[model samples]
Target: MNKKKYQIFISSTYKDLITARNKAMETILGLYQFPIGMEMFSADDSEQWEVIKQTINLSDYYIILIGHRYGSLTQEGISYTEKEYDYAKECKIPILTFIQDRNVPTTTDEREQDPSMSIKLNNFIDKVSATKMCDFWKKPEELPGKIAIALVKAFTANPQIGWTRVKGEKLQAVSSELAETISENRKLREKIEELEKLLVTQKPVLSVSLNSNDPIELTVPTLPSPSKYPQLLRRDHIPAHLTPYITDYDITSYNNSLPSKEEFEEYNKNTRYYHLKKASIDFDISIKNDGKLKAKDIFVTIELPDFVEVQDKFDSYKNVLPKNPIPKSLLEKAKEKYIKDNNIKPKTSFGVTGGLVALGSIIKPYSLEFSSTYDDIIPHLTKSQSINSWSSVKDKTITINVKNLIHTRQKTFDDFVLLPLKAGSGFINISIICEEYDEAENYTFPINVSK
Candidate 1:
């Protein structure tokens, strides 16, 4: 196992069932014999929404502690549970939901009085479930072992998943604010009760010097560390697995350089990085409100005329969209550009292109659901790999299998392919993921089939 550990954020509507949720978390930690990386909120601490996001950002896995009435309304608007899940999705963090057997909210004739709340509640539950996350829906006694197994599987897949989920304040900002506010209210009462006592210590929580809860500040001026502060933060401490494929990287310069949260969020142009000479490129397609944060089903594609070739300039295709959803003419232009630019194109085949057919089916009911996923490498016909699932990844090596794949209705996470490179492959090709294909008994690449 790699010496590096995982940080996971245990997120839920913590107010409603803190005891059961904390016990489940404790059981999970105890089962693992208490690794140094794992952390969870106490009953007194769960009400703070900002703290939850910070925990989520610090963690690799957003362990949603799902029970009845997941602690949203009590905290006020901006459910941290949803925020963490959405942000984690935005950040590409894996989610593992642990559902307790409390009856999930459903509508009945008597309950129809507040059908709106019921509808909202069910929608929230559905959104959380839609991620197709690994779940633990068992009795309290059965939860410990199940949680342990899931963590082990997820950790064996990637220690970073656990490590990054619970690291910083940015993860907890929105979620913990409500909790912190509640904490202050309780503190104010305590302070009133003990007004006669001589105060001995400086209060860090009430100090106005620091910014809001998000620990990962884009502002350099605010990131000053105390003398005893750990100078370097490992992936476990960085909150949320920002880069899912790679094992470790440095953020000192980015921390020192960026101006604010918005600036440091993501770069506009495509950026490239190398892990021991294996090439990886990264570019963010802005998140949409249509409940998708993945690479597939993105509306726009920009091609630098020189960088991309085939039919025509990508700019020309913009006018054709969203009405004529599949731009076959544009793809034809792109194919021409690919052939012209690469020069070593495949010989003319009798069959039509799969890319065209794939795009054409987007509007056919479920056809467009998870199309156009991201891939690190340009997909080729000869060979490919599908990631049904992955177990803890250590030092850049992820144990991947083809059987763990689950259908996701969203475009996020399904965009990248999981390639299990062999030992001695030199560097890990940690690329953008894509979930583009259906499960098949046998699949041959360049899948050009003709009638």
Candidate 2:
């Protein structure tokens, strides 16, 4: 296989950082890639800007170098360097920015002398730095190493369609093989037509079993318990010890501290803990080839009734939580309640000169540990040689493509299907279609579901 070479476009001010641009180009060339720049084109020419955009469009990556002085401005008052950067971004090209360190020493000629130009340079620097990660370069000697590393990282992270060389003889060889294949296919079709005329009707030998039997027993999944979710519980459950100290003020405060009904309902609906707490069961489906001849291109589709739902074993709640389980707002509210109940006066210290305040001892708020227990069941669905792929659910039907099954071979998909059924009774219909038989094999299983 031929290795792909990426074309990187270098954008920078010509007068101030010409040496830096050249170094960047050499770095890309050293990596066995192509480097594109505007050294050949006139910077002030209007026609050249269009060509520059076209070149940038063709580039796989973009590298921009920023120094003390902004490059020559276009008719829109934006620098040519900034214009190229903007165009590259509009084209969706991966860009690497290198801005010169402000603390670095430079000659007067290298820095922008005009106040207005200096402001524009600062604004441009701020724009690039605020948007993306930029490397700071104090010297032109640092360009090659920084450019090489950033380019390598970009190449790995955001790969693009790069250039590859192809030989003309390869195309000709492929054409010859295609012609030979066509001729062989024509002869095989004639033989198949003659064999079809003498063949008799045959029945499919593939058999499907749910849990190694016809009818599958399904049950409604149990809903999550309210006790497991303390957030949804009533907040009026006060401790017996605090009853003597409880006042009407405290009762009113506790009542107002409860989360809004809407917020509570939303949290209950969205939290992964609540969703995963519901218990689910997985059932296995086994397919066997009972014929002497092999079965090819086998497809098994199971049509489920409205009372039952089929889910993948891997399906579960995918919500990502923060490192800290407790919200800061809740913690703050708890701290305020603790301070109010203890009657602790928070003291503030003023400095001698009245310019600053002294730090006070930190208040360690009372801690309450919260935890919940629920069953998290994940079925083991192992890969089988007879199974190819499972199509997405459509119209309550799941289509599973089975690999070529040899004679008398049986493959079991362990815990491959989950039937979360409603409280009702129904029949699941299964159809198996293969190339070895003239008709599709059909089977039906009665299911009784209950809570």
Candidate 3:
């Protein structure tokens, strides 16, 4: 009985995955299959590429190991390893891919340092992951076992015209058959190129996705302290109703608890009152144009909750009265004390009435009201500042990714001043509109606000 041996083309970033490549070769040999790669090809020679393509064409199956390094690129700006994979695909060779697990950090030598190259590699992986059945490997030792299993499955599911030994008289016939197969593969490549050209004229189809799992949440700001506050002030100690309106002076006057100025300041610093600190959320969006036509002027809008408000200095403060009403006699005595302390004339027509009104206003509790507007709710964001450039491209599909789009500082709805935060939480709708499409696609989700 004669055993068949298959030729497997192994492709990857050379230097970075050298050990991985060796393990793959050993696994292939263990299974009695021939492993071929760019090891013998000269680095600078142009003819080596043609040889590489010929080798890929002759191989029965294709296997690629994608790592951090993008490897060297050709004149077309595509990496040589990727080009080989494309050629194998064009030839209809059975392909298996083992990608380095991105979640696991690798050694510096095994990773790509350049940010641009890293983006390219990631894009390439996305393309491969989308198109074929691929496995992820974190270490070189893990690759050989995984690759052996994948190859076994691939062979069982899809068998190819593998190599078998021939006698002296059959050698000439084998050579002729090899030449015929090469000619057929060349014609197939030409046909694939023609189909690709036809596909270029199709209409633009855009695909957009928000990568985040949870909704965008806002962080509450700690209140300002007047330098002297209780060392351990629990949320319960600060009366919920009186909490928002508590001022530095209230600490000393309330219940005759005379806390020093330093304690108040410390308390103020640690409290969560109407501090101008604004809260923001980040968005990670990806847009893809799968058609031949380009997607122009893509715009994305994130809508904040209606309760999230922006306040300005000129905005009127809400009048919050005390929980308990003061007696008339006590009010009159307080008014007299205020006039005497400030040395204001008590005989004017507006007299104590104006002073009483001012006194009443001062005694009333006050806190910031978080609000939002149609315009301020959706802050002006730029594509360059918010979204990232395209990371991957395969056929007509191109992927554009945005790592971070921060919406932290927002102007108050009434005050129109920049504040570190605004407090409100509920369902918010985020929309992405593009000139390429007519209607705006909206993403509505719930956000829970917490400190």
Candidate 4:
């Protein structure tokens, strides 16, 4: 069987996963996605899903990053991840998944969230890894190394470029030794190219010619999730010996690892549109003159496309499908049932709504709503003050990710005064209530917390 060249289609929420997504894509495109901020890109680059779809369609591999809210649907009760995954499944693209930790919920009194590391991460392991699907890194610092590994695996499993067999690429042939030899990032590409060139020079026959008689398969088989995995995705054959390793299993702060797939379903009435609690993203905003506001732990918003209509059920083509921007979501439960019981694709269709919605943290790399420096500095704030909350779904946007949750009892803070959230196109009003009238009428001072 002659394998087709693989182009990875990165599916993720913009605000959350942008940095990581771009970082992953960097191995191939090299800053190609620089301007495509936290939301959907315009006609210039990723204007349509066509580019993503076409890449996945023509290629043999796929990468799905699982952030929090993996299975969230729009008002129409559709999950965007499900839609994209559905398409990937249709194309039979070989998928490798990376999942990150959702916020491990904590109570008000605690300084730390008890570091619920493995339990939260378990959802990821259950849904994503197998012989076919594998993990990306778990920590932010680890993403690049993990992505590099994924790219190597990708280049190996389907070693062909344009028409030639790209040498040094074979599944399972990429040992840690070869990975170690990759050495520094500066020389990485050059070294690989040199190695490939040398191999071609030494063994002229190392390269093979493509033929028309090759059997074109959709996706190669993926390794199955562990039996004890939280959510059992499509169960494929995994070696029995591998089972021993899967038990008690082992999750420590090890090397880089991606989380597993996550999901949600419907218990609502109409099923067309489901109601949701707004995600309140709590963040601390320290304002100074625009040189660089050290907004610690700033969060990104992952809103449904405004154009996406929330209905009781999935929208049929005519009633739902948009000519361009397909931004609709579908109920994962319904799709899973359809696949299990009826074997069909989602009937609902939508175009991407407003700007771009993002998930995953700065680790995934998307729009920079705050200073990129904030990303590198967040871990040092041991005070554990900033927070994010998800409120009700409003106008396609999950309003008030409320990234900063710190309250100040002091009337006068340092130059780092938190200002009123600016009113803009997205807001109804910016309510700045001065709790007590100042004798000097000083607007610069921090007002008392409004009752």
Candidate 5:
């Protein structure tokens, strides 16, 4: 068995991130691969660059770990680390970049001492971030896990031509076998030619019959009642008021003629109603295969147009009376008497004030009942959460398969509530993308919308 190992070049600022570089080397070694770094070269060494280029050329992958320092620069003023990265990129080596997390606080000693060096390091970091997909790590311990994932993904996506060794005896045997197979194949071809000359062949006449189905007429139906068919309330047809009920007091003030506790409980239960109109779109798709051979992986893509906008529902008030009614006559008279007497600003007498207080006490219970009803309606109103299920998606794409060459499929995407944006003669442009057919299958049709 021949085992292949990938040589990965690890380039980064050396001194400041010795710990991170060591961790990376450990990760590559643990994966049973080679890790090349700048450990052998001294600071500001220009002679070793040729050797570094040779190493990068031989490497299968390149990984760089960036830190605060830009490292020693060459005569050209470009850092040696950046020069190595440029060479690796020029050689088309697969590069994985790991950057130090900016959020992580670093000690002053750990960063570049020179301000210019710090600027160069930042510029280098920016270049790497923009050009390649990078990962940020705060600690050296995080390097192993992240590096492992990135290396695995890179190797899987673009596998390198790694070294492999074979036994001399096996190679000789394969060569001998290949020669014998070639000679045998040549003789077999000659025999096949002789046999073909001796055989007689004839072509058969093929007959074809044509049958057609009657034209299909698709009619758009009017919108149906929402109460009758709630499932049809999908898309634009879905009422904005999804809540089943809203109390009458919520819609209006109940200061004067407050209903009795029983009457308030029943009559103010739900006042909101949602009306629905028929939202139906019908269209036909025809598939024709002119070729004699059958096609596989046959598919059709249907792009539905922006049919309608979600609109408010038509509503009407329905009087829902409570079973046990509280006669309004007594409450009405009390309220009327209070209003009449309050017209005159009387003197501040305890007896007169107490009399007025008594009148309020009479109407206070009904007021409490009305307030209680408001509290009770809160839970029910909260439960009436609105969901616009159909409005979320702009269009639908369907892929289908038909058994025969000539086929017509009648497709109806019904129960989808459509609130036509415009009234009368609206065009729905359907885009059809067929995998098998070469010609364009797209078409446009008109729809009439009424509220």
Candidate 6:
């Protein structure tokens, strides 16, 4: 690695601190560092201030020496030394301050003759002392030693990227590499401009819409009663030959009664509701890509109000209920024959062979009993493939990833089911985001739910 030499800027009033400034410059040079000062330009000239700022910009560190005189003022009514210090601070250069000790006696020529200038000098000294930790110097000779110590500490604490001399061969190689890099950068910038123009003209246009824009009406259906089905009581008593015919209704009804508490608990892990009704509404949302380019990595998010709910799958009461292999008509006919044969009285309790218990008045046959061999009393809603494969439901929000949608193609998400928990009116918000679009496309549709 090449050793680096830092450039240090020395800022001070010329007449009062000329000797001190010289000592600072010598100290920096002795340390093998470059020194920049206002020696070349007249401090009072406006044009020289620009040159001073430029030098300060190139410097890694700033050293300011304050004495009895504030020095000559610029057009801005501030001393050139103070102006330079401000510019250094603006550039965020590391600064070292040396203030003259007030106790040290100074000759008439070395001190400020004007009262106004003396006040400004004292204020300037106070400003520097308040802002930075400053060293006190009694004489010009004290600056060299103090400056050397300060510079060493600064170098160790805050190292700077400074000047280094490279070999001739290495310099030529670096020059060639830099030239190639600049040329490549220019070509890349041109390509980027061309791409941006093409993007503006051939942008993908995406439109999202629902199958129906009319406000969705929500309705809640009564929960199916398990007591209506008598076959549930004979789940274990059903013949082995009828096991395949056992519908989800038989299982659900048996589970609801929970005849064996332990077995039912193990079989059903979800919460069970005997009376609470569940309501769900299904809808379709479609997205059409009309632009020339394909819309890649598309995500659609639908957010409903708190009263509405989105579920991955809605539980249906079908083969899940109690099942009995015997038909209800046969059971009724057998009961009438048994009554006529035994001459049983009304409101009599009797146990049938298949764990069938006749309760309440016999005058009223089980009012809700119905018999069907078909398993699909309640049809299953067809699930959308895209939703089943790449969708998630959380509370009232449903997020679906439709992957890449090709140009001039439309995709319909038909699996979304909205369950309303209560009656409410709100807008269903839909947001679509894709790689081809600069921003998300938002849409809304009204929904009114009634009990």
Clashes of each: 70, 0, 40, 81, 4, 16
The candidate that achieves the highest TM-score relative to the unseen native structure: 6
Q: RMSD (Cα, Å) of candidate 3?
A: 21.2
lDDT of 4: 0.37
Which residue pairs clash within candidate 2? none
Tens digits of lDDT, candidate 5, 252-359? 332333445555444333211111222322232344444334433343443433434322121111112223233333333443455465563333433354233334
Distance (Å) between predicted and true CA of 5, model 2?
0.4
Report the poorest 10 consecutive residues by lDDT, candidate 4.
Answer: 409-418
Task: List candidate 3 segments past 4 Å from native.
Answer: 168-451
lDDT of 1 by residue, 140-199 (tens): 566666767777777677556233234467767856987899999999989876763422
On a 0 to 1 TM-score scale, where does candidate 3 land against the true structure? 0.38
RMSD of 6: 14.0
TM-score of each: 0.30, 0.38, 0.38, 0.27, 0.37, 0.44
lDDT of 6 by residue, 146-215 (tens): 9998988888888888898878999999899999999999999999999989988777787777655545
Candidate 5 lDDT score at position 311? 22
Residues 327-360 of candidate 4 have per-residue lDDT tens digits of 1222222224334454333333332212212211
Worst 10 residues of 6 by lDDT: 268-277
- Candidate 5's TM-score reads 0.37
Sort all candidates by lDDT, best to worst. 6, 2, 3, 5, 1, 4
Lowest lDDT sum, 10 consecutive residues, model 2, at 366-375
Clashing pairs in 5: 222-278, 223-277, 223-278, 224-278
Error of 1 at 28 (Å): 3.5
